[model samples]
Target chain A: MGDNMSELLNVKNLKTYFFTKYGTVKAVDGVSFKVDKGETFGIVGESGCGKSITALSIMRLVPDPPGRIVGGEIVLEGEDILKISDNEMRKVRGKKISMILQDPMTSLNPVFTIGIQLEEAIKIHQGLKGRSLRERAIELLEMVQISSAAVRYKNWPHQLSGGMRQRVIGAISVSSEPRLLIADEPTTALDATIQVQFLRLLRELQEKTGVGLVFITHDFGIIARMCQRAAVMYAGRIVETGSVRDLFDNPSHPYTAALMRSLPKLEEKVERLASIEGQPPPLNDDIQGCRFAERCTVAEHQCRLSYPDETEISDGHFVSCWKF
Target chain B: MQRYIVIRFIQTVITLLILSIVIFTLVRMSGDPVLLMLPETATEEDYELMKSQLGLNKPVYQQYLIFLFDAVKGDFGKSIRTRKPVILSIKETLPNSIKLVTVAFVIGFALSIPLGIVAAVKKGTVWDNMARVVTGLGQSIPTFWVGLMLLQIFVVWLRILPASGMDTWQHYVMPATCLGIFLMSGVARLLRSSMLDVLDSEFVKMARIKGVRESVVIWKHALRNSLLSVVSFGGMYIAIMVTGAILVETVFAWPGFGRLAYAAIVNQDFPLIQGVVLTAGAVVMSANFFTDILYAYLDPRIRVQV
Candidate 1:
């Protein structure tokens, strides 16, 4: 287990696109990140910035027909998950890598009791049955800090509050004790206090189990608080990637700098909090230069003519912009 | 829950009382009891004798109370045409129709729901296409025609099952199939749409993220939530089933309320008509009531408000 934690998950150049009647939406266009052994890696961006898409792409759980991972590799551990068979993928899923989706309200099955749903995941992946499965399910609920895990187990999703439901989801996701866990905006729908509690619970679970974490959200505050390393996404591209301290203290990219300025500060009487000026480009349009050039305040003619490669800003930070 | 139930019960009673009074008044107003019964040969006293027999000598308000009393006591009075108590006569035929409709409904659900789920899961593939074709074919052909076609193929052609009439379980195939075809198509369509809605729910994705199996994904997660549409639509389906069974029963010569109603309608026997109409109305009302109760049980938010 110690050796396994030394190197758990890796992803490279992953692209997830939505094939619509209008055109292909490059939702996660050439996005790449890694979740190393026993670390919380956060992806932060605004809505429709492809933060969630990258998470879905890693799980290979994107609904097909309209959306698909069109290109690139997702190497989980030593194996390339994109190349695996469907059956193999199913085996890997929930057993080795599990995910908990956003929106606690909709994520849990409304009709079923939390225990039955929890047992369902345990039984499928572990093939444990009868008393053992029941015991394990109770234990998972306990791990998530639900009160009276035994009694609450019989309650349906609607019976529980939104925060309780989120905890229940957390229980189900980590029941398998997978090497990697992907949480897509798990607290966005929760109340502020509940959100803090849920995030704290996730961090505690990660520390206890030493599971690699890929947490996606639009809120940079959450990223700053929960993650050791953070990546900032803009228009489906990672504009900045580094440790929380490096990304925040010496933010290099103009987009990264703008994002930092947007955060509310009590100390300063602000002339202006930095704001990205334009709506994100229509996902269907073909990309030429920088996808953010239309919105970039400091964008030059070259920035409009062609997209830029990722620039290494330091030993730890990387940003994608010409001014880097 | 008890209070809620009491409120519902009170409401149903008020509704039934209004219905009985309206039916009683309408039956009286439409045509003369004396003329309708006596024919052209009747003298004045003879008309008087017929009116007196029907208790028409009593005041309109008095007549309504007497009728309501008899109805509440399960005596709907003897049919002028059949000379049998209306309640007993209707009861004699209701069981058979219940059997026929219930069998048809169960078989229809059994056959279509799983097929619908499979179609949605393997959507746009061979299974979906096949389901679409089967439901299409089921919908297009008139039910009686299907009964006739089945009778010919299985009875006349192969001589495997009975030709017609409700004698044994073996006899139910043609009649039930006749009714089941349309229901099967309806169930298939309902299940398909509801299953699609559920499949598209964020919960399904969440379940997948939890590492649930593909088979479990469809049945345990998607279909469970999708049941609201199927179960709610079940009320309307069962109501239609009772109504539609009349034709199917008459065609197959099944001794059910449908056949009885058909005969009563053709003969224009007011007593029998009243009985049969009341029975059908009762069944429809009952199905709707149960459906409402079920909806409340399934969704707690509704129960909380109540």
Candidate 2:
């Protein structure tokens, strides 16, 4: 999976915190990962486990009156994006690293036509206009496999179906051919059939463009299907990271093992699906030990006392647990 | 699109017909205009003659039919008080009202939209607080009092502007400001909240992620969506200003439609009263019709629904 591909994005110790009236929420705490050019990296976690926030942090778009990226070095193509000026960062976005957000239903502006929106990104990043701009916009629509591309160009967001809107959003994100594309649960709002089609389309686009894709979702099924390497996030931190084959074949972290058990298997028949007990720790309060310790069936006394360091179990597999 | 417009037009006509019936019945209930027209020394026979002359001797429904027929022909009968055609009076006064209301509408929306945008963008900042204070004062203050205060400050004390009448643009200053201030504040409050909601929407976040400039996001994307609420409010406001600016018009001595309506009510001039109300109702309906069209234009969702 890691054979000689140039690195596209390198994020180290990224910490994004949200200061609310109640207390500060450490959404992404000391998270770190890397994506090589043309690689598909998946971040899997439950709702509120900070997978979305991590993607938003990479985009440098955490809504500020409360949320802030407190610490991080997000380097893309040998450039530290965090250190650049806002003007320079604007250029980097769309042109260098674009993002496809969750919920395509609300991702596109309601008042604008799909064509105008597609053209806008091209106009700003590629500086295209007039006949060329319109042509490029229609071409993007066709590339996303949208039927009646020319007719769909003038159609508003409300005119398109959920699947079609997501496709248009996909087209707009990749219009500038960014080196890295961050898709945050792009299929959650779509139907199961449409989800499969969208994922396939994403993989095809990735193969054609050779763009690094950071796929964020809670579903491990998607991780296994789309990712070359995968990270299992638990309570705002990555508990396990490895090649997809390694992680699936030999799950190391107790949390990962619990998640695997929870999934309904086709071969094994059961009365009820296996479920994890208890909840993740509240992010607002200070967490003293392993965030998953209370819920871990095999938690040791040491696991309750403090967090564990990452240990390399294989050539690429790493797990953070006292057992490891 | 043409179908929508035709449907809206038919709806407007139906609305106007209903409004005419309401005004016609209500005006008659106000008391006999003939009594007001006659002197105390008039004989009972003279009263009968006056009643028959004015066609009050006819049944109420018959009188309404006659009124409706004449109204369709653009003949609003003669004013009982002035002894002139009702349409002539409306024609004479409507231009002044248009001039005043147009200026006020311009001032209200021009100031309110920007104020609302600023308040939303700078939410929780000093500018937002200041806008809150301004809108609060504008909304809370009565229109008549505001008019008088402007008269007291700008006209009476400062003496920089005219006190009454619509001879010059200078005369419009205090009255238009007084009228516009209330609208401005209400719209600003509406726009501020709407803008806040739009700014928080997912599409706005998407726009920022697209590397669009901050100014473009706020002014173009956010402002256009937020203006939907403002446009609806502004449309109704124009109707209100045209027919309901009696307080401001009376205070400023501006010879406008509102003032004409006020005088007709006082004199119990049946034709004039009916004419003024029907005209005001038409204006209101037309304004709303235009507002709906604008809504369809601004939002494609509404257009598809239509």
Candidate 3:
């Protein structure tokens, strides 16, 4: 949907599968999305919904042997990263694109100091050393609003609180000044107030650097607050992709509609919240029909027999459902 | 850190004191060493004289108190067999055991860590499976048998290394290898699992996603974190090797504290046994102390204050 100049990342038909003992798990099955410069693209889904896997696939950091990108085009700045050698992909990873994971407590190496972890990305990408390196590290820390950054540089991950450690991680991810930053539920581990502060800080950083952001989370409130565009993933596929307002106000796909219904709304005196019935189908090699058919309230005979192709409903808004 | 160390040191002292009392009483209860020392034709009067001479006539608690006081000053009395100060012999032989254990430990660590890293990186592949098989054999096989087998293959068959006697470095090959194989298996397994655990952590994945080289990700990030458990295990391993190398030593006829301790045990050399036990206890305690310090160094969270 995006033109060449504005698009920072374009992931097309990305298929990352896990070859397990039981069967092939299509973790990210033909997921397509794009993020433009200075935009926040949110990917929302329940647990095991392949949103995080899609983000990981873009970085080419998927665990091999078990998990692999069977077919895909992750075009970061007009280069197809999947076709390039691992060595080439590495150069693109932190320097061109970086990620902040979910758990800050376990995301930073416990043994190394904050400065060392930050310098890991900076020195590799920027080649700064000595006082310049130290200053750059301090600068990055300060960028993330960590006061007394110089003193905190020597501290280990365990010494810091959850929110502070995450800030340090945020500092590390931005050290290379990448084109795009993927934050996979970065604020999920933090408390409510901290989450707001973190989101605000991220928005501030994004505005300062103009880096494209891919925010993956199940939280609807985050999508409403942060994302410009959003993709709703189900059974390893994007069921709906549109502007956040469009997806919230007018969900076309049955699965997206069900999800919207489940959200707890204030000022509504409902006795109980609506929830989608049944579980998402087990992704298997021989998945014959529409994965969501069994759970879909309006599923017909045809809907149970074949998968629904994506149909564009409005300007740049697409949904995959028989009803659509 | 200082307070923690002081508290740890006190605990070690108390532990050793309890161990000393246990060793003294257990060895005494095993039967009179004087009876074993005296000749078969010796009369009752001669037995009495030998008993008094060796201080076996004293009550058990009194004897332990005297031994404990003397042991604190590095005196473990005279060996019933050699009639030499038991401490002197243990001191003379301890360096040999230390040297052997050091060599073995170096060999074990050098080989096991690499093997472990490879196994973890190439996990579930043929290389990993091969490592598992080799380490499995190392874990299951007895040290004495391993020593004999090494002697048989390297000495008798290949004729590349010496059979026994600690005259040359060549003599250490068999026993060191025997000891090392067992330690290597443990180190390799411990390191492999540790590496796997660390490698699977979100931090390692984060490191990889940060464009750090795979080598750096594995060695710098993963291996260092994995080494925490490996180092702790190493402390206990060194203590085991110091005391348990008796089997390896006997098989290879290597002159070390283990062999001396073995001989002392068999000969019922009261003073020599006590000396060897004390030395072993001290060695273990020292290893644990260093391990604690290492723990603090490796993990900043464990660094105690005041």
> Which ten contiguous residues of candidate 2 chain A have the minimum total lDDT?
A1-10
Model 2 CA lDDT for position A185:
95
RMSD of every prediction: 2.9, 1.8, 2.0
Candidate 2 lDDT by residue in tens digits, A153-203: 999999999999999999989999989999999998899999999999999
Comparison by TM-score, 1 against 3, better one: 3
lDDT tens digits, residues A274-324, model 1? Answer: 677878898888988888888878989999888889888788688889886
After TM-score superposition, what is the CA distance of residue A261 in candidate 1 from its true location, in Å? 2.6
TM-score of chain A of 3: 0.98
Q: What docking grade does candidate 3 earn?
A: high
Question: Can you tell me which runs of candidate 3 are displaced by over 4 Å?
Answer: B33-62
Candidate 3's displacement at residue B142, Å, is 1.7
What would the per-residue lDDT of candidate 2 be over residues B162-220, giving only the tens digit for each residue? 88898888988888898889889989999999999999998998888889999999998
* Candidate 1 lDDT tens digits, B129-174: 9999999898888887887788789988999998767888998888
Task: Give candidate 1 regions above 4 Å deviation.
Answer: A1-5, A270-273, B1-15, B140-142, B145-163, B168-170, B289-305
**Per-prediction DockQ:** 0.59, 0.81, 0.84
What's each prediction's TM-score? 0.92, 0.97, 0.96
